[model samples]
Target: MHHQEIMSESIETTLALVDAEIVCFKFVVCGTVFH
Candidate 1:
């Protein structure tokens, strides 16, 4: 049970990082296009 909890936490963290990266990428793309 403890191992599973750790695994779940890591997965959530990874997803958050990925989401942040995607948002950053989109922002950069939009900025470049608009400028």
Candidate 2:
């Protein structure tokens, strides 16, 4: 139904945000270690 579609889109957006946060975290860790 339409509600389910909206739910899935929100879930996907949340997952994308988490993925970006993880990548940023890793980058910061690596930079700190190298520096």
Candidate 3:
């Protein structure tokens, strides 16, 4: 994939993980971290 695609994928994965963490009550700071 191209460089932009790779970066996009990484951002998506990070957001997914942050969402999961928020859902699981693993952390309450994903908002600032992910954004």
Per-candidate alpha-carbon RMSD to the true structure: 0.4, 0.4, 9.0
Which number leads on TM-score?
1
Q: What is the per-residue lDDT of model 1 for residues 1-35, given as tens digits with 9 covering 90 to 100? A: 99999999999999999999999999999999999
Q: List pairs with backbone clashes in candidate 3.
A: none
**6-30 in candidate 3: lDDT tens per residue?**
9999999999999897787745467
Estimated TM-score for each candidate: 0.95, 0.93, 0.67
- Kindly give the stretch of ten consecutive residues in candidate 3 with the minimal lDDT sum: 24-33
Instruction: Assess candidate 1 and give its TM-score to the true structure.
Output: 0.95
Q: After best superposition, candidate 3 residue 12: deviation in angstroms?
A: 0.2
Give Cα distance to truth, residue 2, candidate 1, Å. Answer: 0.4
Spell out the clash pairs found in candidate 1: none
How well does model 2 score by local distance difference test? 1.00
lDDT of 1: 1.00
